[model samples]
Target: MTGTDQQPVSASLRIDGKDAELEQRLDDELTAFNAAATGAGAPEPLSVRVTDAEGALVGGLTAWVWGSCCAVDMLWVRADQRHAGWGGKLLRAAEEEGARRGCTEVIVSSFTFQAPDFYRGQGYRETGRTEGIPGGHEDVHFHKVLAG
Candidate 1:
């Protein structure tokens, strides 16, 4: 055979037809896994009470205590008394209660629509975040150290 008698080296590309189908299957599996994981757990219930200087209801905070940490589940101030330091006062009170209960840390979660900056101002640091809730608002998580 002559030196030039050889097969042509043609460049070709082969695309996998199952690429899109595999991606869809993986997405479906992930979605099912996430849904199952979320549905397997329930939040702990908490009770809270608040009173004004005159012993009337003004604001309150609620939390679930587990070991050395407490999860602040809710906090509310009277509408008419907002932006007047009542929220901070209530938070401080909650901190005191947590400390009394042997809690070394207090954690809180709120959406972008809530008082993230307020918590930051009160010495809480953002520890985590999530999306896709409350019309895509970010769920901001915060933590604070309690006095022993």
Candidate 2:
């Protein structure tokens, strides 16, 4: 037996106030951890949005860059705004902006029902895939070489 008995959390849960504090602590610790490996700090997070003539947001891409890689966290478009080429335009704009920020590659993920093929058409190559998600869809990872 161990020195003490411990109780597990109720469910897929976290200790109440431990969440943000723990995350922040890990982030702080990772600075030295990452710097030792990469010799650079994390990339600054960036967001790019597309709006209409009336200034309503229709689509956007959010990404971050570090070590010459732009990791896209989100790419979304309003339903009514889809297929008018806005998605592609927004993605390209994000890539161009990343290039300006010195990114040499782009990485993103998509569900099987999402934009995996669309990203492929945009020159991203599939790098990984996993199945058995909650929605029975596959998660696909892609990477692209950005033009200098």
Number of the top candidate by TM-score?
2
Off by over 4 Å in 2: 1-18
Expressed as tens digits, the lDDT of each residue in 1-148 for candidate 2 is 5869787777775457557878888987986698789986766788889998999999998988887889999999999989889889988988998899888999999999988989999999999999987778999999999987
RMSD of 1: 14.3
Candidate 1 lDDT tens digits, 32-143: 7755776522233354666767998888887866556778888988888889887888788777776776679989998989899999999999999998887879999999
User: How much does candidate 2 score in TM-score?
Assistant: 0.83
Give the per-residue Cα lDDT of candidate 1 at 8: 71
Q: How high a TM-score does candidate 1 get?
A: 0.63
Question: What global local distance difference test value does model 2 have?
Answer: 0.88
Q: Each model's number of backbone clashes? A: 0, 0
* Superposed model 1: Cα runs more than 4 Å off: 1-48, 52-56
